[model samples]
Target: MKKIYFLIALFCTVLLHSQERYFLNSDTRLYTSPNTSSAFLGYFRYGAEVRLLSESQNGWYKVQADNFNEGYIQEKFAATRLNAKDVKIKDAENPILEGGDAYYGGNHLFVLVAGLKARALPDKNSKIKEILFTGDPVAVDYVPVNEDDWVNINGNFDEEYARYTLRKFIGLRPNFETLIKDFDNLDVNAVSERKTLSERIVELAWNSEYSKLEPAYQRYYEVVKQINDPKLIAETEMNMALAKGLAKHKLPEQIIAFTKKAEFSLKGTKTKSLYLSQTELVKTFGKPAKKANVGDECGIYLSDLFYYYPDLEVSVDEKKNQAEIVKVYINENNKFIINPNTILDNSVSEKAFIEKYGTYIEASLKSPHNYSIIMEDSQFRLVFKDGKLFSVEIFFYC
Candidate 1:
């Protein structure tokens, strides 16, 4: 037995030495791409230690965690070791506690020894998102896949493991029958935080793949289309892509064209059609300044220039076939502004949400009974009740 233990320890030490390390002596930088010249996403703080996935040729290390592995890290921070002690738990692994289950859906794990320091995410290079680090014993959850590798964990909101390294904790499965009594005070807030964390993963995945704002604004439009929150979906489409496109692309709004096309030069010029379809109007004058819609029925966009001159009133009929332009009161306050469109989509997925939302909100709103709320600029709010979805609401400002 002594020989076995010695051999295992020796092997671990050798593995650690072979792997590279990145030091968070200062603001540890997180990059968007594997190349150093890529845009920066964020950084880790001082006194943090992160392991490198591999050694790069250009004096850079491919370190994982803190969402920084997307790019190569400077070689100066590389460490020549891996020092994580093998984790083991007592008892048959019980993933779902009677009343304690942290539901953030990434790679999760439970600390085997009582009172283990659960850091934010899985690595030291990651940012701190939660206000609390400790969690109720019952709140701890895990999935043991093999004797040496646990698949998942249930840590407190801030005491989370990284999604990618969940397999590392499989050795710590505890038998439910022999486990001590679960924490009497089940923290509802912790559960909600967990759910939010899960959602954040979804957001991040979505943004990473679609929200890079590349391939033009088509991806943003697709995301909004999948969202049930009409308000958010509408608002994001209008504010982020459509509006920006109008100004940047020089697309004219359809409604405003009615006024523009009507030539007052011929006093009482009898026109065949007063109002025109936004698409048709754009063809006559220019493309839309900004436009976003849900399906083909509901959507709202604005023109580049507002008719500040009260003399012209632009109104569209229900059929969208006619427009009546007449003299009306004009208010300087009612100005036509081009706003960018935001991305809103249920399809953003769970992994994407975690990457985007992070852990700050989860730890701050640590209420056993309280839930999670995600708000964007589009007057759209997503509410989760007791760690699950509660509601999604959208409203019009005007």
Candidate 2:
């Protein structure tokens, strides 16, 4: 029995030593399972350490905060080393927190930089009490103080009084999760009202939410103008122009010109529609539901083949071995989508179409009340009947 007890003690020690330690980079809640909707076990502040009990799966990890606290956490919020200090904060010129008279009557401030140093006193040379990280909320009282560059941190930093750099904290935290949720719902008003324009722009630019791209770009443009920063203005204008052009399905040459001048890439912008080959079309739409050889109207083509899919029709010129015309039929249940903002459906109106695609090169009357419009550069043709768009055709000019 003595030998068994000694072996059990040795095994427990080995298990404890084998557990890998991870430091939280962002304040994260411990969940009962690897899901956000699950009941929370506890909340761990940034800079807190946890033992990795299980490997990461589906962006979550089973971690143990202490002997009594074992739960799951998001893998992105934790790192192998306590190196939140390494994450650089952009736009350092405009520090989120300002010193002196800028202090408002707020009870808490969020840490902007990871691994922010908290000292025992207001001086930099004072002994360090603890390190705060990004997103960590520090409680404070906004009483008048003579120190212009330092602020007293209250109970949030381990119960002991500490001093942190005044400019490192922000009155309002960037709520990226709420922004993302609002963006998904296309709540333009809510998204536009979110603070932290620069940070929000970065997140929205990286997202593939095409339906709200134009609105978001417009909002960014409005907000950026207020900033009066030349670099930011140029960037926002370029991005907004790209978003507008993409929504309108501008010519490939025009798109290339816009992209060349822009500093960043739009998430899902593609210029391949102007010169779609048979292989590319096949790859995009899979096998067509029907195919047939049709008489060629243009003398340049030897034969024309019509390929029909759910709500799309492709006219392939056999001699050139390229798709000459692509027609999209819009209906209530159509799955055809040109972009996030441009969906081929009955919901699109003639005015809306013109607004989305930009100015047309020429407009001709097909009949007494029907009209056929050719877009700029003659790459697209739109047919309208009774002031409503019927079909949109992509014309691949040789």
Candidate 3:
């Protein structure tokens, strides 16, 4: 009995320690106690692994850094997982240097990954110049690429230029303090600047691969929380919540609940509601760009007319005087917004779609030639072609 109790106690201790381990999301100071006023023990860099010594106290975490230096750090600055790909580059408006005539002189990027290698050339096999850690700054010559392309650092080069993967860099350097101050003062310029920054952040989050979507949105959420706008804050919260659900491939019932809670507004189409008459739609959006008889193509007995718009296509049944179905094409000019906050466009990958909406109900038989997938619920259907979102179909019920 005594031996069993001892082994049980040892197992519990090991499990507790394993569950408490976390990584620093940002550079944070280690305090001697849970209070900020307490004496400073040391500082931990981003991506530093630490073990929680105790439960959170007043939003502070009792952490043991380096398995020895026990201290307290703010809970918000720590994450269960490392987010090395959440890097951001300084925008043109907020340049690294105040003045420079050179085109790429002011461009600067932040390293999000710990131990990111800086190679002598663009190739992965090239000699490594140095290893960069999270939050490390690097000035560049031009705008960083969005894909797995490489960019040359400003000063880390010699006869051969030093390069790093561009996908690891975000586009804007957010200054939350300045933004809050400007917002409080009702600065118009600041509002415009922040809008641009927000758009860039949203683009980055939306374009991220399915595997990285959570961290990308999490980083965006952190930025959104600093802004002094209630509407934007609410929208961000909705987006984050929806993203979490989608990333997990939630069930139809759960998705319904999420959509109901979000109460997303339809901004792309002229009509406010999906259940609108042809006359109402025309009154709101004027004449369609093109009108076609699609009844025969659809094999529908009723006389159906398909009205094509820049952002949407509506199939109206003449017998009912109501739209039977509405289709939104996901393209470069993605003006159609079924969900304004969670916009899906051509940039979204098929893998991302599968990850978000779960398995497809139907797929194109002619593979290697023309590939497509169809995922449907009661009201909405998503169609993907060639590993990209092609269109979203909305069905109307009587």
Candidate 4:
């Protein structure tokens, strides 16, 4: 065990050592890209140097300067040696442009509206420098970006950004999750048709191959979790489940929906629908009635399996509120349903179901409540009642 662990550690160490770091030249601006046309994140005065984290790629150096976890700069403006003093003069092209406030209007983080391009001189027509993808982080100065407006990246690197796209794109750097959680409160929907852009990006990630999902979804996934709205959470989680199902099981949501006898099959699964799982299924158990006593009147649950709700029902015995046994039934009559309001047929075979859900813990079940199949990092739980499919329940920290 120790030897195996040592090999793993050694391999990781070697991998880390393979990448190289370098220094940026003093008295130049650190643009977000290798080209000179890109928006300058900040000016590195003479004697000011930044850390580079990798070999130059396409004439651009990957950096970790300022508040940025990953950033880019041109090779033309870097020096191999460190400055002995911090007295170097600032450059003119990328002047700090502050009206005398050291904090650049007192804010330190910003973001680019989807598709906003960075310009050479903060002027839209000054020759487009770089194109910022939707949600790309931006660093800037406080002065009003004149092409339309100006923002300031202050900090060791902090800058102000426009909530909506403007001459200069800028805003706060509070992580995607925070921004999205409060999307209903912010006024950043003007650029890139932000609402559409947000959905489009996430949808792309949902459909992307597993290996291709990183860097792309790395942020949005985190954001969706922090959102408080149940509708939004369900929508996002569903997207993620589909993406995972595709990656791990090679079964698209369509097939999954086809296997369930739910209402979603009525219209057919949407092209972007999520692979429904235990989390959504368990939601059907809204509030299990409290049990009164051992054989008390445990009311029977009505069947409501259709379009949105799966075949699910919960029955609890109550002698007046004492307590006994509560039974949750996810009957076989349930159907698989998907979005844009579609319904999957009830004719899907057991083989098709296994293909998407993977092998179960126990090949054969003797009782419904005795077995369950889990998926999505245990976010869902599938209960089998008396050797047959029963109900789905949320199992994660949920």
Candidate 5:
């Protein structure tokens, strides 16, 4: 008799534990520690359902909500307005919305926003019935899947191809088939063999150049397919976030810092810095380094390889213990002028040589010519012309 009673009690306990509750409010907040400011776990809208997982001693119950798991909520807030039977829908039928775009709930469609709104009754004209204000939200009654505007929705729903401008949204609905294929093709052990596919996807998106955001989007998609590293993904997504104007602060300095460390680049290789010629400087370290005008006039040729900025003009003059740099003209205008002194040195160090020429070479103090450094760094190359600094090649490694 005791065994029989134990079996009945276990079955009843399991049955009693299987219950769910639907959210009544339009927005439900999930707190990290049953209090605000802990961390936001995501939010749910009206009619969203959750399966009860566990209960806290202090009136807080843990629940498994959509995407979010182990969420805490006060039992007093457990009051739901949705009827139990209405929470779940039959797979055979789905609710449809009547606006340009609509989101589906349990048994209804909710219009997320109203912009150039339209409506179509079953077997009626496709023309819009009425327009709606920008911020208005309305419920959708039926979906017009068979209609012309709704075709290929699951396949192509980008904002550029969207039927209504206001209906477009960021991110696509999760495609199970594509996600499965992505996971299946991934090789956890080797990634170099799969680089071609990722490159192709990224190249195609970049070549389009339709929108400013397309490049970042392509980079993120390729990152998702090629690399499973969460840190890399997070870094790429941060770039995407900045590209989309989602970042609140100015990132110019951060971007410059990030670019300085990049070893490889999709673009050409070049390092930006001002290079001064010894023949052009009249002074060196508290004394005249070289003659500024040996014969007639001082000639300065300013060449911009990548043309990133305008030409900067600097005047040359001899000073005691150093060279004086003053901007005497700009863009053919002799206007701007400021004097700045730079330390003069005769000896070249390995680090300083690389900083100037992008490489280090055996520094030779050749007679007549003070020094000639053969660059070992791969980013720059220089050719001497007429015993002066000739063509300086800069490579920008992205």
Candidate 6:
């Protein structure tokens, strides 16, 4: 019975670890302990998605990032109030609002702004039917005529006499801090290989010309900005800038050149990385665990050869498939993860990287933003572009 009780406790711990939460404040700091001056565990951006851990005080809350880095944050940065008295929104200059363009689309949505009044129609003049608070999830029956107009939302029959409401205060329910997955953006080359919604959207936004992104991303960003993390705000600005740059460099080649010159990406998390000479490249990944795809179509100008391992893969360009530049890719099944500590989760976000490793490579800050890195004490190397983990390589140097 004692063992059974322990198993129940373990199950409860996992359940708490999986419960999604949000960093309601921008740049909320997570500390190693409950004290404000304790060691800084990590910094969370505005509206950054997190998980609620063990119960805590009214002033402090235990939390965890997607990376599984556990810490504590202040409570004020975590609460969402929807009451008319506590709902704080940027009041429009005009006290009254008008109807938005007619929308005919359908989907479940949420209320972004607190104290939003439910109306009979999409227009403000429509009779007020009910009141909605912040964090309230709803459904929408229509799409706005203009992409930026007020969205029409549905009411819950579960609520007393609840019906449809229309105003600019509504939002699509956020699946935590995720963005754009519903828009069909995925790195589906591998099974269930996924990126954080923010990373996915930012990636497409960075390479907008080659990306098929929806305008709805703009609307989504606006809603998420409420949490006001500086990191997210900067990315949003960069997205707009990339879109503008696309107009200047309309040609494909020119756009690529412009992007290379205009944008520089950062590593999401630093992992132990190492440099391989042409000889080392051939000797290491060349030992394939099973079969590897080798051909011109598989690599640089079809000139590079690639090797596959149970937990890792590497590609090199040379006379054979051995190229001077080598690229390594790692996924959940990569053989390098020889243990639980090396667990490679589907990731593009640095926070995820930091969470899983329990320690981030601070020295990686010195490495070139786009190159592969091997930490001084690490057995594997990670490569990131535009702040997302594109691949990881494992090798033995020790």
The model with the greatest TM-score is 3
Name model 3 segments beyond 4 Å from true.
1-249, 258-271, 283-286, 289-303, 309-311, 317-325, 332-341, 356-379, 395-398
Q: Write the per-residue lDDT of candidate 3 for residues 150-177, one digit (tens) a residue.
A: 6555433243543654444523333333
- How far is each candidate from the true structure, as Cα RMSD in Å? 21.4, 20.7, 21.5, 21.3, 24.2, 23.5
243, model 2: CA deviation in Å?
28
Count clashing residue pairs per candidate.
55, 0, 1, 57, 16, 26
* Residue pairs with clashing backbones, model 2: none
Residue 135 lDDT in candidate 4: 40
- Candidate 2 residue lDDT tens string, 33-147: 9998997744454555566766568999777653225688888877867673645222232222322333233235665543567777657888887766544566543211122
Candidate 4 lDDT over residue span 71-126, tens digit each: 56666555666557534445565433322233234223333355455544434465
The TM-scores, one per candidate, come to 0.20, 0.26, 0.27, 0.24, 0.22, 0.22
C-alpha lDDT (0 to 100) for residue 333 of candidate 2 = 38
lDDT of 5 by residue, 1-398 (tens): 99999888866654454443435333345555676456645443444445455544487656654332356655544544655444432223233222244333332232222133443321125544454332223332112222232211211123232222122311222232343345348775446534433433332222222233334355345646566788667545533433343213224454233223322110121111233443433221222322233221223223211111122222333232222222211122111111122111223332232233321211111121122222222232223333233222333232
* Cα displacement (Å) at residue 377, model 2: 7.3
Task: Identify the candidate with maximal lDDT.
Answer: 3
The runs of at least 3 residues in candidate 1 whose Cα sits more than 4 Å from the true structure, single-residue gaps closed, are 1-22, 33-36, 66-69, 80-398
User: lDDT of candidate 4?
Assistant: 0.40
In TM-score terms, candidate 1 sits at 0.20
lDDT of 6 by residue, 102-187 (tens): 22222244555435677654456868877665445555422232233444344222234435444455544333224454535544
lDDT of 1 by residue, 195-238 (tens): 33332332222223222222223333344454446875644443
Worst 10 residues of 1 by lDDT: 333-342
In order, candidate lDDTs are: 0.34, 0.52, 0.53, 0.40, 0.34, 0.44
